[model samples]
Target: MGPSVAKLASHDRVWQSIRQSAAAMVAEEPILASLVHASVLNQLHFEDALNYILAQCLGTAEAPAILLHQSFDELTTAHPDVGAAARADLAAVCERDPACRSPLEALLFFKGYHAIQTYRLAHALLNKGRRPLALHLQNRMALTFGVDINPAARLGRGIMIDHGTGVVIGETAVVEDGVSILQGVTLGGTGKDEGDRHPKIRRGVMIGAGACILGNIEIGARAKIGAGSVVLQNIPPGCTAAGVPARIIGRCANTEPARDMDQGFDDVEA
Candidate 1:
């Protein structure tokens, strides 16, 4: 009875799912799974949950998971020095959250983790010339997480998304280096045009929550987008945009505030 009790107590469905999924993942892409596993292990000591997420993306309800090792490896190889920045940013987030005890926990529990992972995987597919597959997965990630970023969307170093809900960065949305964005922001399209209908957010811009910058607008470098604003045109550098039909309201003093643009701070009110 004591042994049986211990066995039952040790059982965990979520962990079991992770293990099964990971083993199955070995078949699809052993090298890529190894690469992902290495990354996860380097950042997380016990990363079953993270593995579960990767598996979920690669798995089906009834079938074994497809690991896509080559795809994973290809994506990581595309950004050779990116892991350092990603780790640093993730560390910063963990420090800000009192509940986060380690980078491992942050990697496992944070929505940013999920969003970035989806983006990374999708980006890998995009790089592989799998446009339809990449776009399809990107859309699926958006529907699942409420944060939509295209794999083809060029994101530079130190990009952060805070409280990442309802954030839509359209196809061809070019976000340069050191940009931060809050939640509920849409760098979206204007109409049914086939190409180049989205905004181009330049480097070091801080976009606030619930702000909608529409059409083929170009938001200049270091510009600030205030919460809940709707912009239909271009915004110059060192400016702030606010209100419905968002307009230039103020000057941007600092690009880095309490929360980085990517930290989802824009969702504070909404």
Candidate 2:
């Protein structure tokens, strides 16, 4: 098949899966049939469904649902990569999170997935110098999803924020592709420091829940940060760091710590 036809087929497959899931949800819970139809079955495309869902979650008395929906639609249409990243995030969550059953589940119900997609749109707006609107969306995302990621934060695709509540990614933080961060993770800076602060999390890094990486430190690729550790310095590639002021404990056994989702520090030396 031609490239365009293949792309169309892929989209159709995703839409079909989502529709089937929505139909099953309606059959199982007759009371929520209207909600299912409005959020999923009534939509024409993936972006449209996303717009509807985000509007429902983020809309306020001041902003209103239709305005939020239009903004989301415009962002998805303007930057195709936002939609592509949303799909990749869904796949990442499905593969990484044990609770995720299907792409439809991640797309429809995962707050982490929802937060990241909203962040993508806010990031786009920030890049366009629409600071007020971007910050507004960022605030709404934090209020609705319990995840506060700055609009200026640079994040790559295939990110999984498992149990994303209380996750805070600072303005200058840079999260590369294939990074998995658990709840209460803070990629913040030393107090009152200006310019290019916050951590740079490289590819394939798995950060355990409640880990705090501070300053402008570089977390090298495939590194693992243990749960509740406070990272204050650069972590070398393939290393494991843990403790209050996290130290390089030992080497990581797996090359792809993010994909592996291994939080064990059993083999690491004290």
Candidate 3:
């Protein structure tokens, strides 16, 4: 007797959701709708399609994922040594996040994903002396994504921003390697004055949800900020700061989960 073959369930539900989401996104933000359509069509897997759709709901560039992948590949080919670590950092994050269906998912759904990719493109433009265009795109990204990150900000690799809504990274902000941040966290300026007015976020730091770290203050490496904290001063390394006027409350040797990280998404498991 021949063995029975299992029938694959219809993917109509998934496709329908994708189409509806794409249409809604277009209705909301027509300028980037076509890009979202392209991203949805490009995905080969159902999970990837879902991820991309969810990203649209959360606000992200549908085009940057593809472009950044290509750019990263080119970078790896051209300067293998310099690009290796950054690429590895990206890959490592993807590996750790099982929800990441593909490298493209990592690019689209990860907040740090968009930020890092944009930073690379912006940095390239900065190097090429195309500052205006870079800044223009950066602003566009801020408006489109609801996360204002200046292209000129110097950010190191493996940075993650959970939820990412209301996150503002200023022009003079300097974020070092392995930092993770949550939604409503601001690395911003005190005023409109020209000098350095942004915060310097050191390596391996984690900023909790709705935590506002203002001015040119320094957040030492491996520091952690608790949810809803308003930091107006410097935070030493290995400390966790919380509350309105943030104060050191605990110690963190690793990434601390913020409130935004615990926020739910509506999706059934495959």
Per-model RMSD to reference: 10.1, 3.4, 10.6
Alpha-carbon TM-score of each model against the true structure: 0.68, 0.94, 0.63
Candidate 1 structure quality by residue, lDDT tens digits, 1-270: 145533542474433333344445556668756644543422221233344445555444543344443444445557544444455456555544455555544554466556756676677678778888677667767766778888887676556666779888887888876676777988888788878888888877887778898888899987777778898988888677777887776665555432333323343221
The candidate maximizing lDDT is 2
Work out how many backbone clashes candidate 1 has.
13
TM-score of 3: 0.63
Q: After superposition, how far is residue 11 of candidate 3 from its true place, in Å?
A: 33
Alpha carbon lDDT at 180, candidate 1: 67
Write down the TM-score for model 1: 0.68
**Model 2 RMSD to the real structure?**
3.4
User: For residues 1-270, what per-residue lDDT tens digits would candidate 2 score against the true structure?
Assistant: 245534554577877677778788899999988888888877777888888999999999999989989988998999999998888888899888898887778877889889998899899999989999899999999999999999999999999999799999999999999999999999999999899999999999999999999999999999999999999999998899999999988998788889878799765543
Model 3 stretches astray by more than 4 angstroms: 1-89, 95-104, 253-270
In candidate 2, which residue ranges exceed 4 Å CA deviation? 1-11, 267-270
